[model samples]
Target: MPLTLLPTRASYGPGDPIGIELRGDPPAAAELSVWRLGELVHRQPLLAGAQQTLPELPAGGYGIELEAAGGTVARTAIEVTTDVRARLRYGFVASYRPGKDAAAVADFARRLHLNGIQFYDWAYRHADLLGGGEQYDDALGQPITLDSVRALVASLRAVGTASYGYAAVYAVGPEEWPAWQQHALLRPSGEPYALGDFLFIVDPAAPEWLEHFRDDLAASVAAVGFDGFHLDQYGYPKHAATLDGTPVDVAESFLTMLAGVRDRLPDARLIFNNVNDFPTWSSASAAQDAVYIEPWKPVLTLGALAEVATRARAASNGQPVVLAAYQHVYDQAPAEASDRATAFTMATLLSHGATQLLAGEHGKLLVDPYYVRNHEAEPRTLEFLTRWYDFAVEHDALLLDPAIVEVTASYVGDYNDDLDVAYQEVEVAEAAVPGTVWRRVTRAGDGLVVHLINLVGQGDALWDAPRNPLGKTGPGELRLKFVRGRMPRVRVADPDGRPRLEDVEVRIDGDHAVAILPALDIWQVVHVAL
Candidate 1:
């Protein structure tokens, strides 16, 4: 006999109904009891071969007990708490085995301050079948067995991080290749298209394929005991067969699968990883909890990353936007180029609207020895990321809010062959307060916190420069402005995490505020109370 609870959260809010599922052979008699603080609140007879839903109860700690004729028994504790506003959480995925040591992976996760750990490609056959290949496998060919997964989950849980399973629900493995290639997503022609070597896109419209995918996903979810699924798909069109006998819309099928999964596991959190198809898959907003975009092709610089974050935030209706950038590609020649790219990306995302971060390691996973060895030589980059994790956790409240104001451009620059250089300067007729460069900004309690960055290192001396194209520095002082109300206390934080309280000169003459800084390359975070 096995009994399970749909939501494993120790706490729930008021008016939330509890779902209880029991699986066992028929019994002569069965009873289920709900207890609050050791008092029996409700008692009911259990029906054989059916799930039971407990009535909604008040918010408090609870305990459940079950008994049957054969002396079968089970008990568990539960808690109910008010639902606080959700904030942006960071996560990461680790693939490849680094010496088959689970602690190493856990250590890496802790260093990153990642709230979620994704078991990347554990069920795939290539890594499982090919043994230890240099190109495919890291150093150890450790297969992700159930026990290993459980251990990893426990490790993540110990560090207060959620665990999720990564899988391609609609793709076929290599063992089923060749024959399955015929059903692969075609490139307008009848020939079998290639989506890398391991994955062959299956026509979602095919009845047999759709059935196989649903079963596979459900079974994987049950076997892995993961909190949710990280669904990955190559957002591309297909000229292949359809499941319902008509031309299949791969994007629609993807959403259909997502909705079906949501129906099956109502409590599970689903995140979609489409490289750069957020606009096309906007329909997924209704089905998924978070929207993840991997903009790798355009190779956008820090400014471009900020712009994408703005667009993604709009598409998600103010949900968290995750920017997946390849640090190595930004500057591959210099040893510290990758680290600079990562820092710049994080800074840009934070300035935009506190977007999620995704750092990619090409040769091997973070825990791999090769990666560790290479990283040891350049330790500053690793240290920088560790600090970033700490910063994100500290300012979670400001990052999750929804308020924004535009000020002035302090400095602007471009990446010249991977080197970040500041070159352009614009002037404003009047000084303005701190403004949000990104489209969407998170609320900072009663005040609005905006992120400002200085691209030029030498601009620190330009204290009297105009704040914007139409504004000039007024009285050689910058003023903080708000939406024509009681002015609140203002605070600022530099890139190095220093905070200060100062009176800002502002002119809210036309639904705007202005602030002037004395630097060319400086990032300022302005906090304005509403």
Candidate 2:
């Protein structure tokens, strides 16, 4: 007898009543138990056809294991926290080989603390979608079996991770591009806009094409059971000519399609990729569940990383921001160099309240669009990532809060005088430093958070390229302006894998508090009570 637990629309919150349905025939007598981090939290005897409520629990992660007689039959991941901030921990997975990678999916959730996964390049085709998928090759020629996709989704759900299907909004495969010529967008001089040689761009405004895309999306949702979609774009041809030689505004057309999707499938989740910040504001309509951007070029400095995320969130009217900042250093640099670069990059984005989509299934760093081109992350890199992910989860309330404000001291001559936080061994740089400490400040709840990323001894601010390890920089003085009553209690969260709140004393000089920050390593967060 196969056993299954029905999925819910949204994640459960602490103490929320959970009523789950079990499908398929189970043993006449069974035992059900809920475990969190290895400790059993709830347990009861299971009757084949009886309904029951999960035990009230604290906010964190839990797992449900069903056993028949003495053998374990099923294990389901259950998240007990519904903090909206938790949504910022999304990770992308595309390298899995479907049914063979069910364990990999569970490993991803367990290792990264990711609450959601972007099942990239898992569709049958960009145009046809999963129109009752058979054995079809994905965009990159990877054989895709619909049964494998379904199994992967089921496994991910059992591990408490939401699955999102990846789809290009205006793309059509070459085989169908000829038929979609009339619906294709034309350049000023009349040329079809193409994204590489794989897919051609189509005009979303064309009613015929729009209907096809919409229908495919709906059919895909029903066929594969995707929690949402990761809509992709190439960040070009913002405005193009239609079949009738009429100009079409791409952003408006995108918004129309997104709004239409919401109306047609109100329960569907939508996230559009604003490639390299193009049309971020124009596309950040209410229709989008989150504003997503894949920053490249022009956005080099670490400060600029924060700026990009901050700007996207602002444009989206407070919608969550997901930055698909692919870390390409793993293939070009040593393990230590890659680890430092990855940590800085992640810290910079998280400091600005942005979710990341870099790691995929099997601990691979997504460097190229083709999942096959990704590099296997180093062992140490995975360890650091685990620590980084855990820290982010522990402080989601502070790091992911959208209401936070950026109050970092202004940069001055390679040294921000306000904090006196600069590199000790090398010259200070303005961007995501190869030397200086990158800092961002924000207010959450009754306290303020100062995120300090140690970029000391590192070279270049670009996401890709080789860089050195932490330089000779040590602890430095940190000063901030505080106006709340009572002396501010300070706490620090380092990349040491733990976030214990400690009472820190500061020298109050009038309205400012002067404190000596601990020696820098990679990333640290200082919380000041308001």
Query: TM-scores of the models, in the given order?
Result: 0.63, 0.81
TM-score, structure 1 vs. true: 0.63
Superposed model 1: Cα runs more than 4 Å off: 1-85, 95-99, 126-144, 178-183, 238-245, 278-281, 329-335, 359-377, 402-445, 457-477, 481-488, 497-522
Poorly placed runs, candidate 2 (over 4 Å): 1-12, 16-80, 83-86, 95-98, 409-433, 479-485, 507-514
Candidate 2 per-residue lDDT over residues 1-530, each given as its tens digit: 35654323124666556655576776757888775433467788886464456777777655566777767765444455755333745766665454557666556565565667788887777887874256677767787787777777787776567778888888998878877888888887787889778889997656787788778878877887888888888888888887688888888888777777677668777888888897797888657678889888788667778789888878877777888877777777787877777777788888888878778676878777665677788777876776676556546567766777665545223354434344445443334665666666666777667777766666566655566666655666656556667666666767552233444568898766777667767777887765
Best candidate according to lDDT: 2
- Among all windows of 10 consecutive residues in model 1, the one with the lowest summed lDDT is 415-424
Q: What global local distance difference test value does model 1 have?
A: 0.49
**What would the TM-score be for candidate 2 when compared with the true structure?**
0.81
lDDT of 1 at 514: 49
lDDT of each: 0.49, 0.70
Residue 461 Cα positional deviation in candidate 1, in Å, after optimal superposition: 22
In candidate 1, what are the lDDT values of residues 290-394, reduced to their tens digit? 667766545344545665666666667655556554444322334344444455556667666655544322212132212232223245555555445444533
